[model samples]
Target chain A: MQDPFELSPSECEALLRAGVVGRIALATPTGPHIVPVNYSVVEESIVVLTSPYSLLGTHGRDSMLAFEIDQFDYEYHRGWSVVARGRAEVVTDPAEVERIRKTWPPRPWASGIRTLCLRIRWSELSGRRLGTGWQPMEDLPVHRVV
Target chain B: MQDPFELSPSECEALLRAGVVGRIALATPTGPHIVPVNYSVVEESIVVLTSPYSLLGTHGRDSMLAFEIDQFDYEYHRGWSVVARGRAEVVTDPAEVERIRKTWPPRPWASGIRTLCLRIRWSELSGRRLGTGWQPMEDLPVHRVV
Candidate 1:
């Protein structure tokens, strides 16, 4: 197998835009929590809709967060992962909410009252692709609806 | 869609034993980082073999960490996630290493010199499963070889 290679900025953005679900990593009062979230990439920021009383909604507001998305093949020992690190802020503005709703808004699959919208304006965006002869973008399991 | 229900402790443990890969969440000097690692559950503690100088090895020593594994069906918007939170310790004892090696040892898919063994003795073990009429234990993509 060829060595893993770093993904370009545009490629990372494309993967984030195409992904329907990702994991949010943040430091909680008890410990570090990695929670799965259905997210959208709006203007380079990761947008997620969660419950106000949930673990993410309770502690993720205005907190340093890491958003990760990846596609891996266990049988082949290959995959690509993109991570974005930034501070998250709650979207309280009415206009901003309307705009997000109009764009590629986050559609959570679970049944719950998920009105809280958290946006992570990433300061660092990076990704790595392992294995060779295959493009990471083409291997996405779920395609985002544009 | 049905509301998500809490998984029993036995169910959580079964899923962990069956899973082949999971993500590790921990706090770093920069921020929270989530990295995927091939892991095995040995006596209810998560065991991972990583590089001595990797992120997990550098900051995960005696540090509180969270490990998560899940399987999701994007089309049906249903899935299950299990998380374990605890302090991680590096296994340096030769006898302990021998015992672990005989058991289900971690097999990292990526090419690297992963000699460092970090074990997280989880204090909290919990999980949630969404959807109905399905078993999370039967949904794993990669089954662990016993």
Candidate 2:
């Protein structure tokens, strides 16, 4: 049985950049909520488009959050997972938000008027890969590319 | 533009039963953590095998948690997501654990001892499907089958 290995910072960043969909965990008064989101890596930060009135958009601001992206092959039982722990902030500055949108605009799969942009300024980045040996990223199937 | 619809209890349970992998959200003192896990549904409870010393297993006991399973199609831009929120408990009963093991044992892709069996007794079950029209279950690709 092969053991899971730690991924280096560069490897983790590459995976994060390649990923288009991820789950964001937020702490709420009711409990911890995990919601899938479409994201883009912008200037070493994760940015997503959401509604300001939505639960995540409202409660996520200035709160600690965890963002995760992973790809798993069930047939081979091999996968890689990356987690980013950070504080979320709402991008309210019109110029800043427009600049980010121009560079890395988040196109959410779910149809909605996602006008507010939320950014997660990650403090810790960690990842793990489950397999025998690491292979070139190009060899793997690109599941989602946004 | 399509609207997201609420899923019925039966639909949510069916999706849970069909899923083989899910993400569990745990609130830690430092921050909220989200991690992928292999899980099975037994008696309407989500069961997973994890190491007692691991971050999730150690801090998940009796804590409010969220379990999420989802399938998304990038080409079609449609998907369904289910979230189960409840308190997590360690299954210490030998008989019950043995029964769960025999019924639907979790096969973790990541190598670990994973002796502790954690169960989430969900108090709230909610789901949403992003699309214009709902189709039959068989029409959708079964990404995860337990």
Best by TM-score: 1
lDDT of 1 by residue, A1-146 (tens): 43678999999999988998899999988889989888998997999999899999999998999999888898888888898999999999999999999988998888899989999999999998889889998878898887
Q: Kindly give the stretch of ten consecutive residues in candidate 1 chain A with the minimal lDDT sum.
A: A1-10
lDDT of 2 by residue, B48-116 (tens): 989989989878888999999877766667778899999999999999999998888776777779889
The Cα error of candidate 2 at residue B22, in Å, is 1.0
DockQ of each: 0.67, 0.68
Model 1 CA lDDT for position A114: 90
Q: lDDT by residue for model 1 over B28-89, one digit each (tens)?
A: 98889988888988897999998889989899889999999988898888999999999999
Tens digits of lDDT, candidate 2, A36-101: 898898987999988988878877889999999877766777778899999998889999898987
Interface RMSD of each: 1.6, 2.0
Which pairs, if any, clash in model 2? Answer: none
